[model samples]
Target: MLSSTPLRWPGQARASVAMAFDLDGPTGAAMLDGSLWGKPEYFTFGGYGPYRALPRLLDMLEAHRTPATFFVPAWVVETWPRQCQAIVERGHEVAYHGYQHESFFTLTLAQQRAVMERSAAIFKRHLGLVASGFRTPSGDWHADTPALLLDCGVTYSSSMRGDDRPYFIDAGDASRRLVEIPGRWELDDYASLAYTRAPDYPAGLDRIASYDQTLDNWCREFDGTYREGLCMTTLLHPKISGKPGRIGVLEEFLVHMHSHADVWFATCNDIARFWAQEYADD
Candidate 1:
């Protein structure tokens, strides 16, 4: 469902789309718990994201002539500087995920600030990036996270699932607000695609949705959002969708989306800035 208020897109566009990828390379629970320290297999499994999958995805985006945003952890940038650099070189926005994909809700205010500060510095030093966007590492944030993001110069977040369009999040003061370009779990690749044995993510070992079915669902989602004149932001992961077999699903979905008329494919930063300027009173 969408908000009752009308949302006007730039130019003659009917709806907006933001293709987002989380480049979580060897940085997650496994890395934090030291489980992936000596396990090269496990390490390389996640490593496949930046090492192999990213270049392919970049080329695919370039081929489609589409823009995207990559939410990356600072450690991934530090480990794979050239690969991460290529994301910017290819004309995609690089937003903050976390320092190590840590759970934002589990972190205190001070720890959260520390993570943003450390991450910002790493992005600056390595990629010359001053991130204007963020997606919470764990899909949630602490109470003080919004204000802290403003403090860190982040202008928007694609972490929550409050609405089908762009909205503003007040950071205690009405004068200062952050644009929220919400995304749904249904749009996230990991919910249906990611599979791991040791960590057993999704836990029960029963995961990985059918490619055709997933593509159908993604297209249907785009159709619904487009019909309602809302925004669609995906929670895609390079490690999940960038696999050989699964990349076709993404390609087909993109093709399906591009087939539509007056649909704007934009980066999260552009969407947020437009929302902030257009709906400042809302």
Candidate 2:
């Protein structure tokens, strides 16, 4: 059975839904190096040997004239500072990812705070703009997540999974400095191919229908609550979404979003700032 449905995005205002491309390039390299942290490490799910897919992804975004936010690791900035700086200079946004790409959930509260503080300082020092957003290394955030993020003064974090809409995640605390923006869930290509054993992974373009269905799902969710002005986010890792063959799938989706009125293509910072002003209530 085939079902056709309209696609709606967060805030589905006549305004627009933002398209975010997370540039996770060089750090993928560090992860490839087996990382100083240890084994069972993940550089990429598709296997990361000699296939530098990220540059191609960047080229694709450039071709689309699509601006993105590169949530970069501090180590990457320390190593490839010029490239990180270049991203911002060329109009893309830069946000703090992590210093060592370590999972926040693995760290103690003190360790997490130090990680945030050090990474924020490095991002500001190297790039001139303090990272306004934070993404956990593996989408793994720990129990004290809300307090840690708030204490560090981060504006919004894209690590949560319940919904795609952006919302003021009240930590139910005094330092409520954080907002939780929803991100792609098991929907990521890697999760499907490896974790879920989805057959589409090997079929490539044949999986377009599944991709389309995902987008359709987003639309239905957004349209249902258009008046609520929700925050929606999609996740992309260069290794996963950057394949020459797969990038087009994403590109097609971008075109689809633009063709429809009311979808906004924006940076993470832009979306968060807008949400703060128009969507959030004190």
Candidate 3:
């Protein structure tokens, strides 16, 4: 049988909230397949994230005084250097996603290492960022992914859906482990908000959910997680949640979170560091 232990957050806070965004931009399999060669429309759709939505989202986060984490693909960072820098300038964190949202499950150990190395170098060159955190771009990882990430100097990840609290994944070494700040599908905006007409993408255009219900669901999840004193991290996407029509959903959710007392709003890096330090023995 399994048991649950509530984590005591910093400052005796009831719960911890890490607002994370997967800044994927326009890089994906489309780039690999040559299908996105002339689709300015597709490019525009994804470009909306860094070009327009990011500024609004940044301002909104500033208004709430909340720190966030952006898991960016290296390609996106290279393409939108200024916007990516703005995230750091606004007191947020920039973590690694992948080179071009590649699936680690498809890459060999060597390929994975190369990807991390190239991505890390790109981040360093473009933004002077040494990313300590990672979120798997494809929502899954290779069997040896954890070890490779540690080798690349990544200390934590905001992937996986195993638990609501932070845990450690064995990094193939007894002396060190990578911290995992897990997220859930219920907390991801892509699952509820993204829509595409492409037949190959999502198979249909039925992805969008009711905004009011989605907001309610987010609040309810927060309430339950807060009640249990567990960590809550969102798998949000700027392209999905930053739309003018949907930004209010994020705002209302933030307002609801602020209404509760003793809730710690932090970046994923801070939460992971705290967990790793406070629960070093675990």
Task: Please report the candidate that would top TM-score against the real structure.
Answer: 1
Q: What is the lDDT of residue 194 in candidate 1?
A: 83
Q: What ordering of candidates by TM-score runs from best to worst?
A: 1, 3, 2
Candidate 1 lDDT by residue in tens digits, 20-75 = 99999989888988888978888988999999999999999999989999999999
Candidate 3, residue 232: how far the Cα is off, in Å: 0.7
Off by over 4 Å in 3: none
2 against 3, candidate with superior TM-score: 3
Candidate 2 local lDDT, residue 211:
54
Q: Which stretches of candidate 2 lie over 4 Å from their true place?
A: 1-12, 25-55, 172-177, 192-230
What is every candidate's alpha-carbon RMSD to the true fold?
Answer: 1.4, 6.9, 1.6
Clash pairs for candidate 2: 7-219, 8-219, 16-262, 16-263, 16-264, 17-263, 17-264, 165-231, 166-231
Report lDDT (Cα) of residue 209, candidate 2: 40
Candidate 1: deviation at residue 119, Å?
0.7
lDDT of 2 at 102: 70
User: What's the residue-level lDDT of 210 in candidate 1?
Assistant: 86
